[model samples]
Each structure stands twice: as structure tokens, then as C-alpha cells.
Target: MSEIPRLSKERMNGWAADLLVCLRFCTRVPIPALSFEKSTPEISLAASAYMVPIAGALIGAAAAVILWLATRLGLPTSLAALVTMAALVALTGALHEDGLADFADALGGATQEQRLAIMKDSRIGTFGGLALVIAFLARVMSLAVLTEQSLGLAVTVLIAAAASSRSFALLPLYLLAPARTEGLGAATTDLNERLLTITGITTLVIGLLPLFAGASLARVLGALVVSAAATYGMVVLTRRLIQGQTGDVAGAVQQVAEIATYLVFTSRL
Candidate 1:
């Protein structure tokens, strides 16, 4: 058998180290030999957390390009938006959607233990199914409206919204305790100052971009404000209801944040 390559033990600068940490948390990419000090991983996780927003922006941008192309090809605004949404789902492997579904099923269950069990079941329940459908429908409608208003603006809003939502999702991870002894939450429980700083900076930058492009500053700010509030609220509620945060809860936060961003932006228009 081929020897497994390990993660480099050599000291990595802040950005590179953070990227590695993100890969560790977001995906199963193994860098066996590489290891960072305890403090390093925590900071890296935060930095990685910020990357979620960036990833959202990239996904949004790509989707917008697609929608724009479709329109040029004579597709209706509704169809273009539908295609863009489908493309976004496929690109991310529906990771957030899965989280949302698992969260809904868990939350709707009869009891706390049942909720936790449902979240981990890996099977789709009626609640989860419904949550997925509703979320998708909402996104479709939101994007369609934006597309009809202005394709360029739609793309800008989508990119900003996606990035901002991911940043919002990290709120629970930062505030709440971990639910289980293992999994991604355990691997990334430590919330360092560096991580917080990086996320904060990224969020501010992304949130402001829409305004410079002539978007309503009030509307964009509303989205960011609501998302931040919702994120904090979810963290508080998760602590009270489930006693801690889980992957599913984090996913739920992301879904809500995304929806909040879209709603806030659409309402402005």
C-alpha cells in the first residue's frame, strides 16, 4: 500500500495555515504528517469559517454568470433563476441543504434525544423533506424576483448573500458548546481571537460591496444585521433547547441566514 502523505509540520503563515484548517473542517482531505500547534488549529478554524462566505460569493458569482448567459440565450428570467439555483445546489453537493433537512427533522422530533437521534439518522423524515422543499421554493422565488429586476444586480446580491450567510452560520459554532464528543464540532470547538477577527473583517468587506454598486445600503445592512441577530439567537436557542450546538444546528443557521439575506434584499427591491 502507498504510504499516506501527512500534513506538513513546517510552520505555515497565517493564511496558508488557516486554509489547511478549513480543508480539514469542511472536507475529508487528510494531510497525515502535517500538524499545527493547539492554538494554530483554533485560529485556522475561524479563518476557515470566514472562507464559507467567500465560497458563497464564488458560487453566487458563477450562478449569476450562468443566469446572465441563459438570458442572453433568450431564456425567461424564471427559467434562468431555476437553472442558477440548480447549479448552485449541484456545485456544493447540497451540503447546506442536507444540514437544513437534518436540522428540521431533529428539531421537529418529539423529544431532545429523539431530535439528536433524528439528526444523526442519515435518513430523510417528513419534516426534513418539507424543510428542504420550502427552502428551495423560497430561494427560487427570491432569485426569480431579483433576476426579473436586474440580472446584474441579482448576481451581485446572490454573491453577497451567499457569502454573508456562511459567515452568519459560524455564530453558533463560536458561541455554543459542542453537542457530541466527536465529529466536526469537536474538531473545531476552540474559537480564537484571530479567527473571530478574520471572520469579522471578511463580513464587513462583503456586506459593503453591494452598497458601492448602488444597492440600497439600508437593505444590505438590514440583511447583515438580521443575519447576525438570527445567528446569535440560534446559538442561544440551541443552547437552551438541545444544551449545545451540533453540525445540524450549524447547518440550520446557514439556511436561515441565506434566507434572511434573500428576503432582506428582495424586500428592498
Candidate 2:
């Protein structure tokens, strides 16, 4: 381990600084001279996972603002919601979408090693291309429905869904052995307890905020219950199918969580 920085001043700042680096890595955010001493892999994973909700919150806020503007401009609610969804995808550079596609391709493979090999190929296979289309359509449809019902609720769902998806992705990090010695999976294979705790707290707070905005708390709680179940199920299934987790598995978790959130929201309506 590297020399520990002063805990009093550096701990919180270190977390924030690490999060910014992750944001820059995942998104296009330009941050300045950020450094991490040899922190535990768990810490890095948790920090990266924690950013998902924060980023989701920002994206949700932007979506809400955009929808509000569109409504004021006399656009239909569903159309406004569609535009907002497009903007969110554009902002993130479809990073998760690409992940979802790659995961789909991997899953479509006939064998475990073959699946991992497919995921690493970079070229989108037919399964991947189709999965991307379906995921996007599902997201857009869900947003449109929610916007028609309540813009505020739609925004909350969007943010919560994003955060929870990333939280779901973190489960594989905690439970699975990395498949190879490269990529994000390798970089985050040894996360620490402190980092995991931080991520859990952040994910919970973000995931529940929608409940205060006219969404039923009971339904939100139910969604979380389902998400937890799904996470466990995915972990078990992936272990059996692939012998370990990889970047594709992480992507699948996020995709499933996003869909689960939408399903829970729809049930409440």
C-alpha cells in the first residue's frame, strides 16, 4: 500500500477526487490533476459504482429540465420525454448501451470461453445490435409512459433506475472472480469494505429519493426488493454459465436493473 494520506482532510477529498476520475473515465467530464495512491481494488470499484447514481441524478435533472422546457414550448408530453431520453443517451455517449450490446453477444455464444471471447471482440454482433435496439426502445417507452402520467415521477424513475443499475453492476465485482487480467473487470476486482459501504449508502439514498416525489414509497421499496433478488439470481446464473464475471456480466446486471425499475414503476401505475 502507498503512504496513507491524512484521513481527516484527505479521506473525503480522496473519495471525491477518485469519483471525478471515474466520471472522466466513464463520461466526457474534464477534471484536473487527480491521483490515487495504491488504494484497494474494492475502493476503486465502489467509487466507480458510486458515481453511477450521481451521474444518473445529473442526467435525471437534465431530463426533467428539458421536458419542462418542451412542455412550455407546447410539445406533447410523450414527445418531450422522448427528446429527453435521447439527450441522456447522447450525453453518456451510449456507453451502457454498448455494454448491453456486448453482453448480449456474449450471452448468445455457445460456451463460457466463447462468450468471454465474443464480448472482447469490439465488433457488434447480431445479438448485440438487436439487444441495443430493444434496450433503447424499452427505455424510451418507459420514459414516455411516465412522462405522460407525471414528469416529476418520470425524472425520479430515470435517476433511480440509473443509480440502481450501476449498484446492481457492483454485485458481480463483490462476488465473482475476474475472468482475465485486463479491462475494467481487472481494474476493480479487489474493492474494499469501506468503499462498498459508501456505494451502498449512496445507492440507497439516490434510489429512494423518487419516493418523496409522489411515487409510492411502498412501490419503490418493492422495486428494491426485486432488484436485490434479481442481483442474486444473476450472480448465481453467471457463476454457473461463465465460471466467473466479466465486463459483459456487469453490463447485463445494469440492463436487467434498468428493466426491473421500469417494471416496478409500471406496476404502480
- What lDDT score belongs to each candidate, Candidate 1 first? 0.74, 0.74
Give candidate 2 regions above 4 Å deviation: 1-9, 32-52
Query: lDDT tens digits, residues 24-91, model 1?
Result: 44433354534444435446454466566565666667777888898889988888888888987776
lDDT of 2 by residue, 192-262 (tens): 67767777788888889778778878888888878878888888988887788777778778777887887
Candidate 1, 267: how far from true, in Å? 1.1
Q: In model 1, where do residues sit more than 4 Å from their true spots?
A: 1-17, 20-47
lDDT of 1: 0.74
TM-score against native, each model: 0.83, 0.85
Q: How many backbone clashes does candidate 1 have?
A: 8
**Top candidate, metric TM-score:** 2
